[model samples]
Target: MLSDDELLRYSRQILVQQIDVEGQLRLKQSRALIIGLGGLGSPVALYLAAAGVGELHLADFDTVDLTNLQRQIAHDTQSIGQSKVDSAMARLAAINPQIHLRAHRSALDADSLAAAVAAVDLVLDCSDNFATREAVNAACVAEGKPLVSGAAIRLEGQLSVFDPRRADSPCYHCLYGHGSEAELTCSEAGVVGPLVGLVGSLQALEALKLLAGFGEPLVGRLLLVDALGSRFRELRVKRDPACSVCGSAHG
Candidate 1:
């Protein structure tokens, strides 16, 4: 049930035919986990918090750095040395005091990661590294949770949804397989700020749709964003029957 304040606060969203009062209430009852607090995580956190998701689990082990301000919209110059989780928590709480926020300031190991996924209704993998994404995907598959994954680097970005609950949905591992050894970080390859924000925004939108039980999710499809050319392309993806992480589970 939404209080008068909640109903008024999210009036615009609630006004949408697809997300009326019932969807607003559903958003209020959903729990989500956001991995990482960098470029991609910033907008994802902001939108989800503003949209009235009841509980948000913020997981990040890194501290804010000066270089992060270019795209990490959740932090400011004053947060240079603060933990990413703490900084994001402060911002989110200010946005919607009605929502509950859980912090994971330290890096999550296997057991902790699994526990985190189990506690949430869904997860957003905003992590930059391949290892973290792979680990997160495995955990989501094992826990049977839906994962909204996004990535941006060097003017290119991609967003996808992998739901263990959907038979045709492909987990991250199914698409990237072990990933490339030559993968480069934003620091090394460089990225346009808007690229990550765009991807993150879409990830948030997908999450909202899933939570509110509205429009179609990105499940089994990958959206490619080419910032340099301002073009969007979507590629159909299918679950791999032999995927190392999710194959056996689906089978």
Candidate 2:
């Protein structure tokens, strides 16, 4: 049951016919894990926290650097050198004290990552690297959890959802079997701040839709954002039966 304050705080969201009181309650009971607290994770965490996702698990081993200020909105100048997880937790706590926040300050290895995914109802892969994305996808497939993945680099962004519980939905491995040999990080390629913010905000919206059972998620589609031209395109994606990570699990 929501407290009087919760009702008032989320009244605007609840008023939306698609996300009425029932959906708000569902949001209050869902637990989500957000991996990474950088550009994409920043907005993802903020919106989910504000929307009242009951428990949010924040995982990031990096620390705030001066360069992060341009895109990582969760941390400010005072947070330089502070752990990203700690910084994000502080920001999220301030946004909504009612929601629970968990921290994973250390880098998660295979076993730890599996454990983390197993503990959550859903996962948001705000991670930047291909390796981490593959690992998280494998973990989600093994744990039968839904994953909302988003990435932004330079002026381009992509967003998708993979639900292992659904037969037709493709896992990250299915989409990018072995990823690119030369994947670039934001620091290396440079990204526009608003590009990541846009992708992250979409990631958060997909999470809410999944958690609250309100709308269609990007389960079998990939949304591409071209910031330079301000164009949005979506491509249809399908599960790869031979996908090493999710093939046998789903089969």
The total number of steric clashes, by the backbone 3 Å criterion, in model 1 comes to 0
- Model 1 error, position 144 (Å): 0.4
lDDT tens digits by residue: candidate 2, 1-251: 88899999999999999999999999999999999999999999999999999999999999999999999999999999999999999999999999999999999999999999999999999998999999999899999999999999999999999999999989999999898998898879999999999999999999999999988999999999999999999999999988888888866
Candidate 1: misplaced stretches above 4 Å?
none
lDDT of 2: 0.95
TM-score of each: 0.99, 0.99
Query: What TM-score would you give candidate 1 relative to the actual structure?
Result: 0.99
Model 1 C-alpha lDDT per residue in residues 1-251, reported as the tens digit of each score: 89999999999999999999999999999999999999999999999999999999999999999999999999999999999999999999999999999999999999999999999999999998999999999999999999999999998999999999988888999999999999999989999888899999999999999999999999999999989899999999998898888888867
User: What is residue 1's positional error in candidate 1, in angstroms?
Assistant: 0.9
